[model samples]
Target chain A: MIRPIHAIQIFLIVAVITLVGNWVGMQQINPVDAALGMLILVAMVMAGWWLARVLPVPFPPIVFVSLLGILLTMPWTPGSEWIVSHTTQVNFLATTTPVLAFAGISIGKDLDKFAELGWRIIVVALVVFTGTFLGSAVIAQAMLRLTGQI
Target chain B: MAENEVVEREFEHNWKLYGIVLILTIIGELIGVRTFQVGPGTALLLPMLYALVIGMFLGPKFVKVVSEKDMSDASPLIVLSVLILVAKLGTTIGPNVPQLIGAGPALLMQEFGNLGTLILAMPVAVLLGFKREAIGATFSNAREGALAIIGDVYGLDSPEGRGVLGVYICGTIFGAIYNGIMSGFIASLNIFHPMAIGMASGVGSASMMSAAGGAAAAAIPEAADTILTFAAASNLVTSATGLYMMIFISIPLANLYLRILTGGRE
Candidate 1:
């Protein structure tokens, strides 16, 4: 019963919320704006989940768009050079990467089951992997060829 | 009703182990982000791997162990990690907004390229005979599956859920591959100074826009202020747009392809 149209509707709703939240946050008090922005994000996520239950919408896009909207609208001070420095950016990434890596590892650990799903997962993984590389390369090469940049 | 009661009791009882793993992973991730040089692209892997390990250790029985409390505790870390990433991304954008506009089309095209890979890959998997339930299980458990876990809590572990998981997992692997290929392509174009292909791979996988922007910035820091701008813009857009595009387009495409391939077995 899950339909493709439901996914489209969910995407539209989330996109609207994201745009509205961004516009409103830009006009509001800084802290209040940040908090509201986060709230909007949570609401979008919840909405996606609810929609999935009622319909067949996928969840990643809703989460991604909402996060993107919030990132776009977050308050940033103009004069804080130190905060915006490359070193600081590097530092911030340093603190964040382990968590992501750990998540990857955790997911990889489940590969055994994914493995048990038989060669299907592996075959699919290889096919998806090969297809992506080949597809992107083909497009890139074509674009380069057209531009005479190759 | 009996099945629901059993699942409920099991979830409540095993909640602590889940909490412990979630907390340790968050702490590890926080430390890694703050003190080390791990980027967002790389950082996500940790929790993913941790969950996989936990899944393997706990096996099928522990599926219920990943409870609401675990997700609630883990949510803050996820938010914070992304926030730090955005903060870095914002700094990259603050300096060069105008250039981003000029390069917007190419960047958008790059995104579409990423989407193209997913569209191509999903059907091939389905047509090749990957089970719908397996797809659902994988998607439901991956990062986005945080919500699906909630569905599990409510005893909504149906065929549809499994299908979602399967499709999502397939999409994730494709997403990674797209990053790798695009990163390499960008390097070869010499649109900016080049880094080693391995570094490009890491960057491609690490922070798509940043890696792209960083590479561009490195190549011609002055003439391509626009490159830096595009990099920053693309980073955020890639993350957000990429996710949305996958959900709305890729999932259905996979399902449709599945129907076509399997004669509607799914």
Candidate 2:
């Protein structure tokens, strides 16, 4: 659902959270501010929900949120250390585990619909992987060589 | 009662659905948490894969307490998880930022590499007998953003829609699992820079991106931040440009192939 307006709002919410979370990580969140921290997480979910709306350009909400997160925590900023430190509080694994489980179930529900698509999926998946691998490897190797990073 | 109301009522109290998904999530977390040392510096665990496997096991054939309609809520839940992961990924980057000047060319190569996937996929799909629509769909995985392209330009009822939907479905099931494994394998090879592979991993979904990032970070702890930064940056560029590129650049090229393969009928 992440249309332009929604994307802006969602990004703002996460921007604030990244700002506060990083600050807390660097210092300490008093009991009063803890409520604000909880609110930020909730706002983030609501903002994430806006992502369900689909953007005009087809970009996912993750890109916007990440970009905003990065902007809020720029290393050279006045106090970027807090943002980086609290970044771990997001607990990516704990969150993704459930999401993946739900994703599996969502897929299973469409098994009948999917079986009709035939076997080409296997070949296509492998091809996509190979193409990306070769393309990335060739470019990476060349870039490293050109830059003398390798 | 009307059919709509009946359906709404069913959805109103799908407690069993939540319970089942909760159990599945727990199962997945337990497995994802069980990392084993593969080497002095490497470790492995496939939480996403494990969750998917257990979920597939709970399908109608085995467990009917939950219906597709009930699990409908999973969509937003999944998106939220992806959001959290992406935001967290952002944090890992901002500070440990590498030489920005170096990332410029590397990012370009990775983007082309992602587009290269479409170039490679289209021919194989056409060889296997897909037409303009299916071929187009197969050319791009069309996971989250690409789906919009398929729906807008090529009606979902078109062959392309069906093709992209199929690819999207398969990707949902396997993209993350494979992307994670690919990262670990690529990292293990010690050939490409962890920075480069991180960018490659960004071509897939958020979870896939995280898995790829995780593999690189685990393999080379020192370069962990650099790996994540490159992966996020490359992903941002790919997604932002992918829609236009898919429409303006890749589609026309695919159509050329379609014409050649179909004897100019395309």
Candidate 3:
């Protein structure tokens, strides 16, 4: 079984690979860093897949962290600024817009199911949402008062 | 063997649905942004909602229809999309490190600040008798809505994809609430500082920050620096505490409330 320590090891390995790839690629072709970044991402995915299969624990957080780090950091890496600027805009649109659309569509699709549950789910969602909002606000206000921000 | 085959086939079938959803999501995003001046993140809400609606319509059949491969393929795309969005946003907003540090402690504290309230609220929600599947469906649907487009684009449709979607939605909602309340409270302090307002909103969501900024601007236009400072600080705090708060507090509270309302049906 893969231990948490193993997950850490895998993360370190991925990071090292990315760092070395970035350094070497920076000295060569312009697109090399982006290519290396993609490679690191793919490697992280593979690591996650493997860890999920072999590990007895829930899943490796490191794999996700490694992949996420590489994906976010890729734009800043040497030789990839142009792609980063152009694609970054597209990338945000690609990621967040879909999620929002999906939420709306999914909720709309489940209208009937939600209907069966009727006011219960609505009430619950509203209550939880409101509770969270109110709770956070109160806590924040108190904190600000204490901190003299108020 | 037959059951295994069935599962595999089901997984494959789900991927096909996801593909269609993906294309629709892209179209929706393009149209929304181009036509409405809505940002990509805001535009994404539609496609995600649509997919959840479809998934619900598909019902239990969804389980059989979605294959493991379909789910697996969808996750990476979602991750990619998130990375892209963050990078783009970083550029637009520029770096605001001090704001982040200043707000970080309070934001983090707020994550656990309402433990008693959550615990109290869960039992109340449970006693009211809520449905588990409904709650699960809402949670699941909310997640699917957010990631459906990205998943579709990248051909990801795995359990992992679903997990990411779920986490993202919950995190956003949690962050929004935390930041919103904090900002409102801060405003009440009459500090008249945009930095405080921005920090509060930043710890929540961009939308919240925008709303806070508008209010601050309307009230006092000259304090733009304070507003900018607040936004920067709050944004950092939001990013730093977003995931941590969601995992530790939001999900558990939701689940706890779900269980109580459903009478342990889940």
* Model 3 residue B178 lDDT score: 33
lDDT over C-alpha atoms for residue A34 of model 3: 45
Q: Give the TM-score of candidate 3.
A: 0.54
Candidate 1 local lDDT, A84-133, one digit each (tens) = 33222133223223333223233333434444455465454444433433
TM-score on alpha carbons, each prediction = 0.48, 0.57, 0.54
Task: Estimate the TM-score for candidate 1.
Answer: 0.48
DockQ values per model: 0.11, 0.31, 0.15
**Tens digits of per-residue lDDT for model 1, B47-136:** 233332443333223555444443332322232223333333334444433433454333444544443444555565555555564333
lDDT of 2 by residue, B1-266 (tens): 11223334322333464566566655554444444433332234455457655765566666765565654544333443445545555555556454333457767666667656766787787777677544545556565445444544553334665576566655656666666677777777888787777777677456667777777778778888988888777766565556556666666666776777678876
TM-score of chain A of each: 0.34, 0.49, 0.40
What does the lDDT read for residue B51 in candidate 3? 36
Q: Which is superior by DockQ, 1 or 3?
A: 3
- Scored against the true structure, residue A53 in model 3 reaches a CA lDDT of 56
Model 3, residue B132: C-alpha shift (Å): 2.6
Off by over 4 Å in 1: A1-115, A140-150, B1-18, B21-48, B59-100, B133-204, B207-237
Q: Model 1 lDDT vs. the true structure?
A: 0.38
After superposition, the stretches of candidate 3 with alpha carbons farther than 4 Å from their true spots are: A1-57, A60-67, A70-89, A96-111, A115-130, A145-150, B1-15, B34-104, B113-129, B133-198, B216-228, B256-266
